[model samples]
Target: MFECFLEIGFEAELNTKEDPELMEIAYEQCKENVATRATAITELRKMIFARGECHPLRTDDEYLLRFLRAREFIVPRAHKLMVRYCTFREQNKHLYEGVDLWGLVKVKDAYEGTMLDRPDTGRLSVFRFGRWDPNEFPVEDLVRAGMAMTEIGLRQPKLQILAGTVIVDLEGISYRHVATLTPTVAYQIVCLMGVAIPGRIKGVHIINYSWILNTFFYLFKKFIPQEAWQYIHFHGSDLKSLHKHLDLEVLPERYGGTYRGVSSFGIWLNKIKKYRDEQFDREMKQLGYVIKE
Candidate 1:
């Protein structure tokens, strides 16, 4: 039944195929073209190999293009992102230990939703902090799960080209949830979403906001980059305000939209199982992700 929704708009966009329209978007927004793309990827590869670290790196055009697109085909910026990405993995090796979707099923608070049916936007991914049980699952595990999902999403050209948005629902957040975010973890999170990954996040909408959420933000505001912080919009239980940025039809009823369907991680897990091949495993391994049995 959930697959029906997947079939509607999400499934088709999950592939690597590049449509003419999306290609135009890429060219206009990211300056991507045959000549520029070749040059950028080559420059990025040269920079990456010059580091003499990040061994077993996948320097193929497809893999390198991700960073190039993320940085709008700017070789230097893309190279920096690749370095920071590798550095993040090296510093937080524990997060990748045995991190896979199957292992992350217990993390029930987050799920990827479909993009707006409109052709203008990419996708919207939602994370519900209020539904998270910190005691049942460690914050580290939650971060790991999030990283796994992001890696999977990045495989699609649609996501890379069109970019995406994130919704952080903070309705039921409590002090206990806030306490779990140590200063170190807060910094790591800021770096993870803000810089390390190639995800072209268009915006992040924070709805159902409460003072507890504000307290968390206040304590960690210094860690957040100014540009990224600017992208964050807080709507305190005001779905009307949230709808101004996003179409109401695309949002689920829980977010004050008319859509009555439920968003489930299980549906996403099933959909992404196709990515659990030998090649995907190798890619993860090369990126320093430990694939636990």
Candidate 2:
């Protein structure tokens, strides 16, 4: 079975405005954007698992176990509101479910506990004030735990892939109200393998398009040195071929190609360039203040 969780959270510091019409429009727009992204994620998950036999009307013990494990990591600490849009299958039927997964948990306690217990989980723990804290009960951790539980579930061999977009309103204007506006979208996708053998599991693929975009951003920021940190947007269709390079080693297990010395050297050189440029900008900004006699 394939399962996915697409989450969206809003963080904004709006000025005191008395227009109720504008506020209503902003709220509705954000809701619609989130809903559309969630639907896109559901479609992507189905596409990845189309070859497998989907089960309907069956209890997902493995999924429940992973969910519980995730709860143990995030709840009782952060005190932040969380909503989950989950999709899964049982006996040839697709299931869609949503819940306020962290409603009962204390956020602050959970956040501190997760940071202290990082070694036990073998994952990093950190918080982003406005953005979603993926480290605190992230999808990656859930996939790892769920794959391990597949042995006990006796389910068919399958892979669950998740993909979605993150829309940031650049002008502080909600894109949902603009009718034709397309916000800068960042897509992330992860794949988890289903195994029938107990105590043996593998991560077939865990690819996110965001990485490629990051790589490009690094290169551009290093070589181009633009004044503003502009972002590159990607659509769902732009991520189709990310798995091609890893197909041999990840999927079917065969030799494809190899990287040489020059390629390695170039990668390091680019990283150094980017680091130096960033430092230069910081120093220049600090030096801008001066006293005149």
Cα RMSD for candidates in order: 2.8, 25.1
Tell me the lDDT of candidate 1. 0.72
lDDT of 2 by residue, 180-262 (tens): 21121111111122111111121112222232434333322333213212322323232233234222122211122121111
Model 1 residue 96 CA deviation (Å) reads 0.8
> What local distance difference test score does each model get?
0.72, 0.22
Error of 1 at 245 (Å): 1.0
Count clashes in each candidate, considering only residues at least 3 apart in sequence or on different chains.
0, 17
Task: Please give, for residues 178-211, the per-residue lDDT of candidate 1 as tens digits.
Answer: 8888887877766656578886777888877766
Model 1, position 45, has a per-residue lDDT of: 84
Most lDDT-accurate candidate: 1
